[model samples]
Target: MNWLNYSEACARNQAVILAELQPLLATTTRVLEIGSGSGQHAVHFAAALPHLRWQPTDLAAHLPDLGANLLRFGSDNIDPPLALDVTQEPWPAGPVDAIYTANTLHIMGWPQAVALLQGAGRLLEPGGLLCIYGPFRYAGRYTSASNAEFDRWLQQRDPCSAIRDVEAIRDQAHACGFALERDISMPANNQLLVWRKAV
Candidate 1:
């Protein structure tokens, strides 16, 4: 029962992610974080924004590692890890005011990624915010040569895992009761896409 993992990238980018989410989550009472891997962002964000409750979730197999990380760095505002698989019918009970997930889309297949958006559509309250952070291609082109290499590396590991298209995600968001709000540039060729659940 030793579940421990470390993600240096999560530590490095936690601040940037928090800065992006601060204003967006200002009035949000509850926020659900999908793929809360290592729980680093969960602890950092929850500690910084004490007003909002942070609910961390991941696949059942990933829960223990997340739980272990939370135990070391968690704040009072964060909740226990919940099991969440995007393809599973009926996501965890919620009408959450905000959702935050990082580096998840490219890791999951296209269909699973779509399911994630669809599940977020169902769980989010009207006007709720969903912030997705990852590398994305635009118009079938990679943003940078490094990104192209990264995509190749990803596909080599798992064919289904590769950077997604921005337009495709935008279209799926529209279908899932979301309206594109902002697309922010981030460090290391990553992008943060924000969408709001239409009222």
Candidate 2:
């Protein structure tokens, strides 16, 4: 039987995410996608935004499924999946017009999340964009009861993983030479945050 990985969340959110990313990335040429789980978003975004050369990456273990998904359904604009652990040094790709990641921060431990932001700072040029899509807490408050439940579930699954605080992330990104440009609300109690590196 043929098998390929899939993410129901990715399937649900790709359209709305694309609506936000389409204009933000219109003038851009390349995009580096961190934690390209199942390669679903990569395929969807690449197919929609053909102007972008999309580089999808994830942990080594996920590469097989990710690569298979990309090979089977990805567009020419989509590159093969690469191994990328946020804590590791020397990311596989170079400077790009923008960096994108979805539903990743809350899955990573705090240190890894910090490292991912730092790595984006290093790889992106001044004025480049870093677009992140995920759930976040504002002023230590969850946007909805469902998000609170999700946080509890996440912590139960992995003690170090829970919805991150927007203020803390903003402060950290600022320290890394990025300024929060936009924080747009999305469906399912999620957010699409855009940051731009100092020019």
Candidate 3:
């Protein structure tokens, strides 16, 4: 039997994410995708953005499924999956053109999330783009009732996991020498935040 991890939400969101990624990634040659869950986006984006070499990374446990997905649908542009834990140092030694992470922060503890941002800062070259996609609270308030409920659910499931505020995220990103360049409102109350590494 063929085995590959699947995520309905990933399938649903990949297109919108790709639309946002295209222009942001147009000038990029190397991209590192953090938390490549299910590898759905890796396959889809690699097929669409053939010019970039997409490096997918995640915790070791997910490597098999991620690798399987890559073997199944990945093209030449998609590199083999790499083991990455944000809290651990030396993020694959990248001076990449772009860094992309989707639906990851809210699921991790805040400290790890901050570490991820810091690592992104170190990974990107000057003027590189950092794209983060997920629901975010604005001005300390949830954007929608559904997002509020989702935050509650996330906290209930894992105390460390909850929606992050745009303000807090900005502060963290700013500390890493990144500046918010674009904030695209995406479907399902999520936001695609683009931060540019200072040149």
Candidate 4:
């Protein structure tokens, strides 16, 4: 299946995210990527950072296209894709050294986002990292005009899919036993949010 071809602004920012992620993930042995859409970022990062094993996962329907993209890159470090849905009653896998998801939260409703964070907390070992990348609202304001427009487009497509407030996300992370580590601003108005599981 072609699996619905489309491009996202987030995909264009992968290299910038990898630059920030590389140093923090230098010692990480395994990384579980949620919502591995198109598998572009996973293949690119796994090829760039050969030391860390990248486990790309998404809904079962998305696996074929994701796998095909991974094959295109031919990176040994990227493991076969896994079927994972945050809203499911139980996750399908074990713990991971780190969890990464880009531009997924805004695509999901608030409840699903909370469930994803809770599941991440459960799967991450103490001191493990959770990295989320995407545009977000901060202090009741949009960080950029482009992001504001993107949020409008998102809500138009799905009322539940709107740019999330950073503060609310931080609060949810805290409730899930995660501590906010860094909020790095990236190109194209996106932000890289790093949270560490409390030790």
Q: Cα lDDT of all candidates, in order?
A: 0.91, 0.93, 0.91, 0.89
Clashing pairs in 4: none
In the range 1-199, model 3's lDDT, one tens digit per residue, is: 3437678899899998998898888878999999998888988998899888999999999999889878887899999999999989887747688999999999999999999999998888999999999999998899899999999999999999999999999999999999999999999999999999999
Against the hidden reference, what TM-scores do the models get? Answer: 0.97, 0.98, 0.97, 0.94
**Candidate 2 local distance difference test against the native:** 0.93
Quote the lDDT for 183 in model 2.
96
Cα TM-score of candidate 3: 0.97
Q: Which stretches of candidate 4 lie over 4 Å from their true place?
A: 1-11
- How far is 191's C-alpha from truth in model 2 (Å)? 0.2
Residue-wise lDDT of candidate 4 within 1-199, one digit each (tens)?
3323435654578779889999989999999999998887887798888998999999899888778877776489999988998989578766788999998999999999999999999999999999999889998799998888889999999999989999999999999999999999988788899999999
lDDT by residue for model 1 over 1-199, one digit each (tens)?
Answer: 3326778888889899889889888899999999998888898999999999999999999887788888877899998899999899888858799999999999999999999999999989999999999899999999999999999999999999989999999999999999999999999889999999999
Evaluated at residue 114, the lDDT of candidate 3 is 98
Against the true structure, candidate 3 has what lDDT?
0.91
Question: Which model scores highest in lDDT?
Answer: 2
Worst 10 residues of 3 by lDDT: 1-10
The reply for model 2, stretches above 4 Å from the true place, is 1-3
